[model samples]
Target: MASVSVSFPKYMSHIPTRHAGHLAELCIVPRNLSLMKQGSVRELRIVRSSNQTEPLIDCTNKPSDIPLLSCSEATERLKQNREKHKGKQQFLAMYSSIYGGTVTDAAAMAIPMDDHMVHRGHGVFDTAATMNGYLYELEQHFDRIIRSASMAKIVLPFDRETIRRILLQTVSASKCIKGSLRYWISAGPGDFQLSPSGCNQPALYAIVIEDQSLFDSKGIKVVTSSIPIKPPQFATTKSVNYPPNVLSKMEAEEKGAYAAIWLDEDGFVAEGPNMNVAFVTKEKELLMPNFDKILSGCTAKRFLTLAEGLMTAGKLHGIRVDNVSVEEGKRADEMMLIGSGILVRPVVQ
Candidate 1:
């Protein structure tokens, strides 16, 4: 392969030229990226000379601190970041240790998640938005975290306030500029007796992730799965018991669909792989699957609240849904799955 040249913006210091080809991975925001014509040759910019200037993210110079790094330079630096977990992190990722967490200090010998709790197979978790850079429902997520922990007997190291501070610290240390936050807490691992015990110091970690799924006007395609959604005793708690959801998604992927609708054991529409499934029929009625076995979603709550407001003001013209049958949802004109990762995804399967 031929060599590719790379360069940093005026603010960034001189980076070794060896990082050329890898500088092509830093992608632009979803919008700009999609505008570029596919299969077109992208030009790589190289600075022939260097002048001392502020770094892209660290330029404190009052004049202009924010440096705009070209695609290649950003990509190169990203490529050099080795994401290896040197200590207990490896164990956690391998399911040898707790696997419940938002971020793991792999370099530190800390288990941040519960990978083996029997209750984990049936627990739930949720993350809310951050207002003015502060988590809007940070408290709510914390509550759910503890709930999941209790159901799984996972010991969290920090309290609500302490956890909040930790969350801010991670975001300050992260590269995310904006958009929602996340939490990954699980029941502590335990024996096969279908009880949560014998697991100590369960992993409780959180972070902020890009909210890719928003009120995207574009609709989505979905493939309903034959697999049944099992009744999760700890459905209200956010735990890492994710096999059922994962498999439902796998079934969808097998059919080239964006997501799958999980049906209850009784063969009724339950929810989406990672969201609450909802539909509005042409008859002007809103329908949703029972939340008994579904993850209590924050985004879904917001959507419902908005729907209620619209209905109250006579701005909306449909029924606020509580539950719907799988057969009815399948027959609806539109279907959507709402969740943290994908806020509101419209589906056609």
Candidate 2:
């Protein structure tokens, strides 16, 4: 276990950046989201909440991740996206303002991003989602974030409760209706050294947003990746070392695909550069890598849970829940992309 520290970044210079013209696009559109598994190209759509019949809002002042609406309108917004528009949907990034500016009781300040991440990509973070407004299984994401902090030796200033509260509150305060949420924490700022202690200006935030509309209906289209996912030592760390995955996803996009799935040095199905891979058999079963090379996913674990439930329910004998050969994966009746954002994304290779 690693002890966490709280404070400023080591090398946060006063270098400024041109105001991002796509700030709105950056927050709402998945146009430039982190890498995700296969999907066709399509225009993204936004669904605003409908608080009509009953109000879902809580008069109480406590902050929430998914905003409470009047029970009526909440019911309406949560109803469903009217089916009409059609296009190939691709990106999935939607981060909300956890604090300050808008969309929350307590808006957050515009804290500066560190040069280390901007220049060297030397930061760490974690992502998780909310189920019915609650951050589904938070302990796992929190543990992973702590692990990321430990690996990079970046200390966090707040206690687990503080962080947990912020995450939950952010989710509960949102009016996302139904969808996913993404959260991250940085080592702040630091020097150019590989060590993490130099990160002085740490920032923590949680955002609530919906996923691409098409994914809910038709499955995603993916390609076997040319680039492979790295092992835990280099690839496992959840640092802002995102350029590699970002570039790979970009490459995939250029080819009209969704993500770059990585093969380990041993040449096995490791995982997508971002999400975990689950190979479901024709017999109604699923499998994920057990080498710990891939990020242990919440839904991945649920796949195992579902399998066991099915077994208990006599759905099947059992599922081969561990990693298997890429040949085996290719033969899977169906492949799934599992993660906080995707929930369970079907993959059509």
Candidate 3:
């Protein structure tokens, strides 16, 4: 581990930033944030987080061996790389507030490297599902993203109505009827700094990703995550700070599970990495954990409303949102995960 002396406030010290010759390293700064004078500096060390001692790359290439390219040369290389790595899901269109337009070419759809969201994780995002030329629960998702942006302290790049229109136009331009529309609001491109104050302005980015596969109702295995859950303040916000989520998912995958489930500080069922968890109890109640400690999932909320019809049809006894214990959840007759991306997926184990 490498250490650096920082002169700024100590609160900003824990943020791990990229440094030379390593994936991540910790630098200490001040905690109580205040306006700093010139040369008030923070020290950073680019250190590896993992235990692996070997370098990621062999010592075969050097700075002198690299070839510098012009703008057009870089664009051509990006296009070639994109074409060579095409996958099942297609990126149809993207809207960037930075450029004030939509781009159909995947090579052209890129966010600035210095965007606070890119390096500092100062952003919030949400997604809408498109089906048969219509956006499902677009209003609700849009509202949630706005709330998330507010919670993340990222100002909207444009008014709500204008943003909505831009989203609609991006999806329309894509002509993708059976996919999802994802968008982000970031602190915008600026110098790489922990504070968003240096950002020139906020930015909005939207992309349409086309998925042609039919929905599968298959149940999947899940495991309790060893990774700790985030605090309620951060957990409830759909921000781009997803390192915990990513690690939890990786843990589940390592255990041959679909997704890892997190428990609250009190050991009550919280949620999956990216989706809401729901259970159908033996008594036929649609049971879900309260949203005060987890993300207020739009798809999960909509499903709760739709499930009301099932109660009317005598399929469910009632619906309840409360603290669900692990034993209680495990004993439930049916378990499922709900989210915009996965919709409703049954969990078998």
By the lDDT metric, which is better: model 2 or model 3? Answer: 3
Higher TM-score: candidate 1 or 3?
3
Error of 3 at 336 (Å): 0.9
Angstrom error of the Cα, residue 10, model 3: value is: 26
1-349 per-residue lDDT for model 3 (tens digits):
2233345434535645443223223222245533223433322233345443423333322345568999999999999999999887899999999999999999999999999999988999999988997888899999999999988888899999999999999999999989999999999998998898999999999999999878888889999999999999999999999999999999999999999999999999999999999999999999999999999999889999999999999999999999999999999999999988788999998
Q: Each candidate's TM vs. the true structure? A: 0.59, 0.62, 0.83
Instruction: Please write out the lDDT profile of model 2 over residues 149-173, one tens digit for every residue.
Output: 7786656656789777766666665
How far off is residue 36 in model 2, in Å? 50
Name the regions of candidate 1 deviating beyond 4 angstroms. 1-125, 129-136, 186-200, 210-216, 313-315
Q: What total of clashing residue pairs does each candidate reach?
A: 21, 57, 9
Leading candidate by TM-score: 3
Off by over 4 Å in 2: 1-109, 172-180, 190-201, 210-215, 282-285
TM-score order, best first, reads 3, 2, 1
Cα displacement (Å) at residue 328, model 3: 0.6
- In terms of lDDT, model 2 sits at 0.59
